[model samples]
Target: MTTDPLSATFAALADPTRRAMLARLAEGEATVNELAEPFSISLQAISRHVKVLEQAGLITRSRDAQRRPCTLRLAPLDDAVDWLEEHRQVLEGRLDRLEVHLRTIQQKNQEHDQ
Candidate 1:
């Protein structure tokens, strides 16, 4: 089954290797061999990770002669960030309300005790 864009972006980012790859790409474009250099995994594995990032719209791979370099595409990351920021604001508002209610209850208890 097909997944939503946000879900796909999250799923691709769930892996540490994929996340690292994205970080590397953030610095600049890198070939599969270049991405695989820091890891002990085979080039094939790195290529697979690249494919997932590409599918998630987090990166784009372009051919430059024999080399296929992967570049970061920030739109998906921006979307994810927007989603997280929206939820954070909602949660923060809930916490603020809860704190107000708790303080009010505490004041009432103090008055009753007095």
Candidate 2:
């Protein structure tokens, strides 16, 4: 387990099965068997994937009588998304500056052609 929440979230998302599980959970909470039904893997495998998601803080499992329903946890995901958006804004700003510089060069070229 990484000390960084973002890194842990990314790591958890890196697995396709886990990503699919998250998507399924997004619709609503599901039992382990429900989450495992879409894939050919064993229930144990799904349980392992669920454990990783739980560790990453992406999902929470609560007991409802005999069922342990897994619900999606949005806080870590929101934080990850916020982090990505921050970097995206920084890149967009750089691209905006580049666009301005290119426009200036184009204007200079037009003047020279004239």
- Candidates in order, TM-scores: namely 0.94, 0.87
Candidate 1 global lDDT: 0.94
lDDT for each candidate structure: 0.94, 0.95
Best-fitting candidate, measured by TM-score? 1
The TM-score measured for candidate 1 stands at 0.94
Candidate 1 per-residue lDDT, tens place, 19-106, comes to 9999999999998888999999888888888889989999998999998888999999999999999999999999999999999999
RMSD of 2: 1.7
lDDT of 2 by residue, 1-114 (tens): 346889999999999999999999999999999999999999899999999999989999999999889999999999999999999999999999999999999999999999
